[model samples]
Target: MSAGRAQAFWLRNLTAKIAAIPMILTSLVIFIGCSIWTVVYSFTSSRSLPVTDFVGFRQYERLFGAHRWSLAVENIAIYGVLTLVFALTVGFILAALLDQKIRFESIFRTIFLYPYAMSFIVTGVVWQWMFNPGLGIQHFVRQLGFENFTFDLISNRNTVIYAIAIAGIWQITGFAMVLMLAGLRAVDDQIWKASRVDGIPAWKTYVMIIIPMMRGVFVTSLVIIAAGIVKLYDLVVAMTNGGPGFASDVPAMYVYNWLFERANLGHAMAASTMMLLTVLIIMVPWFYMEYGRKNKN
Candidate 1:
């Protein structure tokens, strides 16, 4: 580019750039700086305080060896996978139904999206009550007719993670639906006409053409749900408290417990660093594909 053109590009959004300077500095100093600090401390033998005595991967070794941490990791894996699959499937189905130009569309959208507005804690509490064996679904069902029915999944060790996933899917599916609906609406009317002209089925058009076109929206929903799955502490605390012998424990809860309850800052930092790395592994490539390549072009 010519010198004058380069100068014009730099000065094109001068005021907006000036306004963004504080935010950019804040992100660099707060987010990146604290992340580096945390990773550094993860190598140390700090307990109840931040210490300089670096012990390499000793803290990480202990973190991985702990049974509680293992359970937490396993639970998160199961929960995360189930949440992702169900949220995407259910959300897309709901969005497709809404796209049919049905009556009371806004009312249905509001009803569906209402759960996302509620805090995770509130969702957890409400679901906990509904899942309570004595006073909830089980009792209500038995009173009606069936006395042999037992719906105590929340209190069962084997099924507690599934219960957590139920609450998570309920609260997040609506948000996914909204995103998918927006993506569906963005489809060109001519594309549908072309598909119809070719005698293509609606489902085939969606699967072969429309979904591929909505790739960005799908990625956005995936990232949003994945982030929530990783940081799944609040709902677990409110509903299960990692109970039934740490059956529903997740990584974030493990990190918090090690840091505060166990007073093992190094271990907590190590766990948190692992979570950060996991998020980056999932996000960095998507970021590059979505934005970096566009910039280069």
Candidate 2:
């Protein structure tokens, strides 16, 4: 390209670029800068104050060796897996059902999507009450006829993770359904018509044709849900408070407790760095496949 063309290229969309400068700078200073600062401090022996006394990997070693941290890791793993599986399955099913031209479709869609409008904290609190053995499902069931029924999953260490998963799924499934429904709506009418003409069953068409074509939608939903799983903290705080002896503890909560409660900044930063790496591990390849490859092509 000529010097003039290169100059023009640089000057292209100058106004829009100028408008975006604030946000661009904000991201650099906040996200990137803060991330680097945290990673650097993670190597130190910083307590309540930010210090420069480097301790190598002692903080990391301690973080991994801590029983609470280990339990948090295990809990998050189980919660993340179950949340992704059930959220995708239930959301897709609900989306498929809504795709059918049923009566009161708008009403059904609104009902399904309503839960997602509320904050996770609110959802957690509501579900917390519902899970209470004395006041929630157990009591309701006993009042009916099954007086022996016991639904105290939230208070049990082994079962508390499942309770957290339940609230997480309820709050998120609606968002997933909306995304899948949008993907379903984007499918061409001719594809369905052709499938019908070919005498292909609806379920078969969805499984073989529709789903395969909604790859972008599926990936988008997966990334969103995965990010939520990694940053899970507020719901656990509002619902279980890592209660029943730290049974429902997650990595985010662990980070918070170390940073604020215990005044162990270095320890918290180490854990936060680990969470960041974990998110990047899941996201880097996804970004490459979704956008990097497209740019290359």
Full-model lDDT for every candidate:
0.94, 0.93
lDDT string, candidate 1, 1-297, tens digits: 699999999999999999999999889988999999999999999999999999999999998898888999999999999999999999999999999989999999999999999999999999999999999999999999999999999999999999989999999999999999999999999999999999999999999999999988999899988988999999999999999878889999989998999898999999999999999999998888889768988
Question: What is the lDDT for 89 in model 1?
Answer: 91
How many clashes in each structure? 0, 0
lDDT of 2: 0.93
- Candidate 1 residues lying further than 4 Å off, grouped into runs, are 1-21
- How far does residue 133 in candidate 2 sit from its true spot (Å)? 0.7
Tens digits of lDDT, candidate 2, 87-182: 998999999999999899889889888888998899899999999899899999999999889889999989999998999998889899999999
TM-score of 2: 0.93
Best by lDDT: 1
Model 1 clash pairs? none
